[model samples]
Structures are given as C-alpha cells and as structure tokens.
Target: MQVYKAFFKIIQKNRGQILIYLVVFMVLALLLTNTYNPPQDTDFSKVKVNIAFINNDSDSQLVAGLKTYLDENANLVDLPDDTQKLQDALFFREVEYILRVPAGFTEAMLSGQNVQLEKTTVPDSTSNVYMDLLINKYLNTAQTYTTYLPGLSQADLTQYLARDLAEQSEVTLISNGSHSANAEKSGYYFNYLSYSMFAILILGVSSVMLVFNDTDLKRRNLCSPIRSATINFQMILGNLSFAILTWLVLISASFVMYGSFMFTPPGMLLLLNSFVFTLAALSISYLIGNLVKSRGAMSAVANVFALGTSFISGVFVPQELLGDNVLTIASFTPTYWYIKANNEIAAAVSFNADTLQSIFTSMVLVLAFGVAVLAVTLVLIKQRRVEA
Candidate 1:
C-alpha cells in the first residue's frame, strides 16, 4: 500500500545521499580494520641492575663484556662500586639487583681456579623477572663453555660466556589474559571506533529523515485508506532495511580488512548486536522530530545528543580508562552497549564473569532505551494530534 509507496518514494528521492554515506562508511571501515603498525616500536626496553665490584678492574675484558651486554640489551644505569650507595639505592627502590666481583677474580679465572661471582637481587620485584631470565641464560652459556676443549681454559670460558651474553635477546610478554596469538589493543580500538562512529553517523541522518517526513507528510497520509498502524509498520520496515543495508556493507569491509577475525562468533555478534542501537536511534529521532518544528533544529539536536552520548559512553575511547563513575553513567547509553559488545567479541576465547555480565547488561540497556524512547514518541504523537 500507500505506506509502502511512500517508503519507496523516500528511498528514490534520497538515493544519492544515502549511497554517498554508505560509501564513506565502507571506506572508513576498511581503513580501520586494515592491519597497520602499532602506536609504538616493538622493542622492549628492559630495566637494568646495578653492580658493585670489589678489587675488580673496570678495564678488564670480562668487565667490559658484561658492561656491553647490559648496555646493548637492558636499560642500564651504571653506578660506582661504593657499597653504601649500592645498598641505599636498592633499599630505596632505586635498583633491583647488584653484582659484586671479589678481588683476585681475574687471577683465579686465569689460574684455573673455580671462582663464583656474586649477583645480589631483591626478594620480590618486577625487574627480578627479566633479571632471572637473563641470569639463567648467562649461566647456561657459561656451562656450555665448560664443555669446550674437554676442559675450558678460564680465559677461553670467559671469552665464550662474554660472546654469548653480548648476543642474548630480550623477551617481552604482551597479553590480554587468554592466548589470542598476536592480537593487540590497537586493533580492537580501531574496530570498535570505526563501527560505532560510522553507525552513529548513518543512523543519525537516516533517523532524522524518517522522523522529519512523518511530521511533514504523515497527516496527509492519515486521511487515506491506509491505517496509521500499517503506515508506521511500513516506515519501520524501510528504516530497518536501510539500517541492515549499511550494516552489511560495513561487515564486508571489516571482513576484507580484518580477515577471519571479523567472522568469529564474537566479532559478528558485535556487528549484529549493534542493530538494537539502531532501534534506539529511530526512537530518539521520533522524539526529536515530534518536539521540534524544523529539520535544521532536529539535525542540530540529534548531532549534539549523538556526540554527547558517544563521548560519555566511551565510543571514542575504551570505557576502562574512564573510571567507575563515568563508566556507570555510560551504561545507560545505547552507544556504550554497542562498544562493550565489540570488546567482548575481541576477547571471545577468554569469556569470563566480567565480559559475560557486560554483554548481558548492554543488550538489556539497549532494549530498555529503545522501549522508553518509543513510549515517549507515542506520547508526543498523541499530544500533537490532540492539539491539532
């Protein structure tokens, strides 16, 4: 019927604008999903330890070798061998470990005597982890030198250990709890921002049109044979069709850029779950159109409200950084639900109490917002008709 015809007319009239918006969103989705360099270099700057040597010649080859090893691979801050300074720095949390080279260290090693060097470390400290790994690697390299020439000469063993230590590599752990392979926080950030920002733009404009036409032409259609309920239903169908159309375009772009990660249950679930926000958008648009007399005013109000919601809900940034108070307020916005759903999808393999609760809460809030806004729209429509 007439409602369907009116819907088609709107589509035909606005096809160019709609197509342009869809294209822009598609390009943005591709850009966001595409793999790119992380915000920082991949190299890990490891913490360095302090060493105080007694009767140790700083110019000795072994000392030079160890110094080079620390310089090239760690964040070494060289300090004098004063025991007072060393102990004070360590106690004050300035240093995690200290190395002590006793007198006759070089003579013992050169004379074939077994000399054990002392490396002091804090009982429990963050730097201890990296220090432990480095110490183990150095020890293993030392043992390997003992196997050289059936019995390694002290000088030869020192040389071999120094060479191995100089070339030792540092390891860093960047994880989000679960074993997600090479996933990074930046990829997740891009995905959610691209989806959410574009979704808001598309729905915001479409919602205005859907609401604006009702105020302008709905009364004329009311006098026709078609019932108001049927007209409203058809309008809903048209808006949903456009919403889904935009969604599919975005999904395709994401898939091309992100590969299989975009199709997993968590990822696709996020994309589909965002449709609830579209309903919320429609309802809000209805409220605005009913309250305002001009399309300009409606657009201004919608854009401002949409941006405000986007900011408060952490669509521009992750909600975790916003602290509890901002995050609590964010929970009431449909945009927050959409972004939360995306985060859950990114960490799908490690589903747990917090993420599951977030998913459930977001869906419930979106449904509630949609319902509340629709009820308001209905009230506005009734009052407008009564006044007329």
Candidate 2:
C-alpha cells in the first residue's frame, strides 16, 4: 500500500505536464473541427453561363429557333464585331464561350448538307465543353426531324426542336447507419489522446520506477522481511493504477466534449479501440522504464516513440495520403492498427459479423504487440537481477 501511494505521489507531482498536453490537444481538436466548413447544397437550375453569340445567318425559322435556345440556356452578352473586345471578354472570364453561326447554316440544314458551327473559348474551359455538348444535342435532334419528316413545315420543325426534353432526376442521399460526418473529428481527438497517454505513462511510471531502482533503496528493500515478489507486485499495482487513471481522464474528457454521441455504436467501438491501444502503450512504457536508467533518457524515449509513431501511423496525416511503403512500416506499430480500426468503424453500416471480425482482429494484433514487449521486458529484468 505504501509503495502504491508513493508511486501515485510521483504521478501527482507530474500532473501539470499531463494537464498541459491534454488542454493543448483539446484546443487543437476544436480548431480543426471549426476550420473545415462544408458548403451548402446548391440549386443547379439557377446556374447560368455567360456566352457571346454572333449570328451571320440570314432570317430563317431554324436560325431564329437556335438563337432562342441559346438565349434561354445561357446569359447572352452582346458585343461589337471587334476581335479585341471578344478576346478581352474571354481573358477576363466574363464569357465562357463565343459561338459563331456561319452564313447559309439554315440553308445547309434545310437541304440536308453537312454544316459546322464554330466556337472559341479560353483553353481548358470546362463550361465551354458543356455548352458545346448542349449545342450538338439540340442541332442533332433538329437534323433528325428534318430527315424523317419531309412533309412538316419548317415552322413546325422549329417548334418541335425548341421543346424541352430533358428528364428531371430526383436525388435522395441515404446515411449508411454510421456516424461518418463526425468520424474525422472523433478520430482527431482519440489519436492525440493516444500520443499524450504514451508520453505521460512513460514519464510518470519510469520516474517512480527509477526511484525504486536506486542502489541504496534496493539494498534496504532486500534486507527487509518483505519478499521481493511482494515488492514487485506492489510496483505493478501502482503502475496499473496510474495507467487506468490516465486512460479514464482522457476518455472522460472525450465524452464531455462529444456528449452522448460517444456512446453510439461506432463511438463505442472507437473507445474500445483506444483502450486496447492504451494497453499497448503501457506495455511499451514498462519496457522503456526497465531499459532506461535515467529520467532524461526516459523523457527522450517518450518523445521519439510518441511523436514519431503518431506522425507515421496516420494520427497527424490521413492514411489515404500516406505512401504504401510508409503504411507497410507503420503496420508494425499498435497506433497503425488503432487508426485502421477507427477508419473501418467509421465506414461500417451495422454491427455485423464482418465489421466486428475486422475490429476484433485489429484488437488481437494490438494485444499481441503488448504481450511480446512485456515478455521481453520481463526477461531483461530477470537478467539484470541475475547480474546483480
């Protein structure tokens, strides 16, 4: 009990450092959430492109009908027949397309002869292509009508060509039963939590363990009536208590920030995933404490492990942008599995066997890493004792 109390006292002394990390990360999470603003749904019917039309064709129903179609679909900007004004309009992006209907275009269409409409625009203009396709569709239908119905008058054909035949499609978006909208925000919070927890556990537990590893304290403990096994058990209890307390503080803060949403199926999976990662971090800290003899070295180890792993394992940057080689290397770390599982959870529609299986597989892999590190730490500790 005394040893456990002493261990907690060391952690309490370092509470300021732990609190600083927590506050900074929380502020960062809030800032990130605010920085990303999604645009509202837009009404496509209101969209109009500015276009310049030059009609050199003589008076005919077909030419008049084509001009009316262009006016209705686009904003027709009247410009003088000067090359300079037309070039300026295109350069300034005031008009997306300049369409010229050559002389005899109406006659060629009436006589079933091949005719071409000339168009000019700024290079690589997307709106220009859309306008071109619209013109082609209109003219193609007019050509078909003239070819098949020779008996119909030109006025009748023009009226038929001007009719709107576009089908209105209704789009309905469905949610996949997952909290995908909030998933990125949740991931940011938990990723930073893992980083802060790793550093805190290493610095807190290792510092206390160092005190116990002191030569005089070790000799005195050996001389005491208490068994070495009992002393080791107390140390383990202290470390475990500190780790659980740290995990709870972080988890609770997440809940307070996100509210009841944290209890949702996906959110619950995130919590469990983080818990498994915390265990892996604890084992890593234990290994580092056993190997490192000084507080300075332990602090250095904490920074390298925590920051390096976070950056490489998609905590700082998204996994989608990371290179294949980087992900392959990160696969060896527990943070990789934690982030990967979070991604899978965010994509899952329901709590099905497939989703659960993948998540459990990641958890198992994380536990395996912890167990392996702990086994090596135990062997190292036993070897050191034998040498002493």
Candidate 3:
C-alpha cells in the first residue's frame, strides 16, 4: 500500500509534464484528423491531372478524338503555345504534363511508322507517368487495329479505339462502412494513438518506477514490514491502474467526439486493439524505467522510443505506402502489428470467421510482445535484487 501510494504521489508530482504531453498530443491528433478528410465513398475514380495540350498537327478526326480522350481522362489546361509560358506552367505546377502532337502524328499512326509524339512534362511527376501510360495504351491499341484492319478509314479507326478504351473493369470497395465520417476519424485517432499512448505510458510508468528504483527507497521498503513480493505486487497494481485510466481517458475521448458510433462493432474492436497496444507500451516503459538511471533520461527515452517507433510503424505514414524492407523491419515491433490490425479492422466489411481470425492473430502477437518484455523486465529486476 505504501509503495502504491508513493507511486501515484510521484505521478502527482510530475503531473504538469504529464498533462502537457497529453494535451499537446490530443490537440495535434484533432488537428490532423480535421485536415485530412478522406473521401466518404469508396468508389474508384481516376485522379485527373492538369495537362496543357498543344496541337501542332492540322485538324483531323483522329486528333479530335485524341483531344476528347485526354479531356475525358485529365484536366486539360488551356495554355498559349508559347514555349516560355508552357515551361512556366510546368514550373509552377499549373500543369503536370504537356503534349505536342507532331504534324504527321495521325498519318504516322495510319502508316504504322515509329515516330514519337513530342512532349514536355514537369520533371519527376507521377501524373506524368500515368499520362505516358495512357497515351501509350491509346497509340499501341490504335496501331494494333491499323495493322490488323488495313482497309479501315481514320474515322472508323477513331471509333474503334474509343469503343475499345471505353471498356473498364468494375471495382468494388469491400469495406465495413469505414468510409462513414465517424469511422474514418476514429481510424485516424487509433493510428495516432500509438504515439500518445506510448508516450504517456512511458511517462507514467517510468515516473513511478524511477522513484522505486532509488536504492535508498528500495532499502527502506525492504526494511518495512511488507514483504518484497507485496511491494512489487502493489507497484504493478499502481502501474496497471494508471495505464488503464489513461486508456479510458483516450477511449472516452473517441466516444465523446464520435458519439454512439464508438459503440459499434468495428469501433469496439478498435478499442480492443488500443487496449492491447497499451499493455505492450507499458511493458516497454517498465523496461526503459529500469534501464534508465536518472530522470533526465526519461524525456530522451520517451521521445526516441515513442516518435521513432511511430515513424517506422505506420503511425505517421501508412503501411500501404511503406516499402517491403521497411515493413519487414517494422514487423519486429508490436506497434506495426497493432497498426496493421487497426487497418484491417477498418477495412473489414464483414465479420466472418476468416476476418476475425486475422484480426485476433494480430492482437495475440501484440499481447505476446508485452508478455515477453515483461518477462525480461522481471529477470532484470531479479538480477539487480541479487546483486544488492
């Protein structure tokens, strides 16, 4: 009881720092969620890039058809044919791509000659790549038609290419209503939760553990009537209580911000992931608290451990965009699995056995990380006790 009382007393003494960390992170989370508004619907839509089209070639049905196709797939910017103006347009990001159709462009395609279409582009533009792919697809398909159908006229050629290109595969968004405004925001909160939760747990547990780690405090507790086991147990209880309270506050914030939507199935599972992650974070904090010999080291440990892992674990960035090597490295950390689970949880359109199995597997891996770290912490503590 004494150790437990002292544990929270230390927390109270350090309340200012704790409160600052909590408030700052919570505000940041809110701001980020507000700024990043994901689309409400999961419908597939092509990202149209701005392009400046300059037709050096004479008027022809094929060219008109090409311009119409560009219009359909991209945002064609009306820019003067001046070289300086086009360069400036690209430099200023007013256009992601530029196309200059040569005078014989249509004839070259009809003749099946290998003459390239002259083009300008914003350097290293992703949209430029897509535009290139699109144009190649059109030209290649048109050439194939011309080679195979020698008697086809230009108007007939344009008609055939347009019809062929119009065919597109259907895409279905298999998600569990994650596009709902509340669910999208909730997913963001959960992803960013790793950082704040890690920091707070580290701060809270380390503050208490640091105090108890003091040699004089340890000797005093040993000399007291309470057994070593009781002191350790009470300390564990205090740490767990603090961790649980912090978790509740965060969870409650989501519920408050999102209303009853938080009680939905996906939302509740999000809560479960956060809870498991909190335990792993607590174990990490315990290890850091014991290893770090002074209060001055706590801030460094918290920032480095919290922020570093957040960056590598798909908290700041997304797992989808992360490279395979980065993901492989991230897999070693429980934060990766936690975020991975959170992602799957949101995208889970159905709660069939297969989906649940994947989600539970991730959760179990996270818990395993916590249990393993706790075992290591116990071993370290036991070794120190023997030496003392």
| Candidates, ranked, lDDT | 3, 2, 1
TM-scores, all candidates, are 0.61, 0.84, 0.70
Q: Which candidate is the best by lDDT?
A: 3
lDDT, candidate 3, 197-247, per-residue tens: 898888878878887888998888778899988987898899899999988
Instruction: Locate the minimum summed-lDDT window of 10 residues in model 3.
Output: 173-182
- Candidate 3, residue 253: the lDDT equals 73
Question: What tens-digit string does per-residue lDDT give for candidate 2 at 231-313?
Answer: 89999888888888888878786687678768888789889988888888889999888778887797788889888998899
Best-fitting candidate, scored by TM-score: 2
> Higher-lDDT candidate among 1 and 2?
2
| Model 3: per-residue Cα lDDT at residue 80 | 98
Of the two candidates 1 and 2, the one with more favorable TM-score, higher being better, is 2
lDDT of each: 0.60, 0.82, 0.86
CA lDDT, candidate 3, residue 262: 79
Give the per-residue lDDT digits (tens) of candidate 1, residues 1-388: 6555655575566566455545655555455546544445445554455533333644566555555555554556567777788778778866676666666665554444566667666877666667657655654565555544545555666677776555645677775555343234323543444334443434344544554356446667667787878877876676566556555554555555556755655555565565566667656655664566554564456457766776777666667778888888877777777777666665566666887787777767877887997798788778867887
Return the lDDT, model 2, position 313.
90
